[model samples]
Target: MAVEVKYVVVRNGEEKMTFATKKEADAYDKMLDLADSLGEWLQQAPLNLDDEQREGLSFFLAEHKDALGQILRGAAPAEAPKKAAKVKMEKSVATSKEGSTSEKQAA
Candidate 1:
């Protein structure tokens, strides 16, 4: 029912990465993309790195995400966003709270 990938960070030997399913893979990929963009954006405006260097860094990260993480990072490959079990519990709690609030307001 779920696809999972276990990855170890090369630089930080102790860091472990795991994704529950294809959706999780996709969410991670998007996260990587945003991080990459933010790095570039920072360099261009406030950071002011040269354009050539910026392009090179983007290319490098795009090419190397798999080595950085557990699997080859690409587009959102999963149909749904993979969420941690803890997040699911949090969502349930929030929903219950909202329901209770609604009942109180109705009363």
Candidate 2:
């Protein structure tokens, strides 16, 4: 027999998600709370957004809260995308080098 403990986040009597660790579950629940608040804020904005658009945008903002915070604090948003692409390319090159079949060429 095996023993397992899982943390579940439930909202409105529905199980939203389950996690192996309490930290992750708590983080997810907090993000949901942020998203809900953002949704309400969007409703009061002058720009007209449908329900789905507001919900999607709210979640996106919550998920990228750290990056958004940086932008809000005067960080240059344009720089991050190029740096992210470069890092991704570097990672791919490193992975390919590790799987190289021969000294002359990669597998």
Q: Which candidate should be chosen as best, given TM-score against the real structure?
A: 2
Model 2 TM-score on a 0 to 1 scale:
0.69
Question: How do the residues 1-107 of candidate 2 rate in per-residue lDDT, one tens digit apiece?
Answer: 99999999999999999999999999999999999999999999998899999999999999989889779967667777777799999999998887774655742
The ten-residue window of minimal lDDT in model 2 covers 98-107
The segments of candidate 2 whose C-alpha lies over 4 angstroms from its true place after superposition are 77-107
Reference-based TM-score of each model: 0.30, 0.69
Give per-residue CA lDDT, model 1, range 17-104, as digits (tens).
Answer: 4565667656656655655685666575655577777766665666555444433343243412353456788999999999999999
State the local distance difference test value for candidate 2.
Answer: 0.91
Relative to the true structure, how large is the alpha-carbon lDDT of every model?
0.60, 0.91
**Collision count for each candidate, in order:** 0, 0
lDDT of 1 at 34: 58
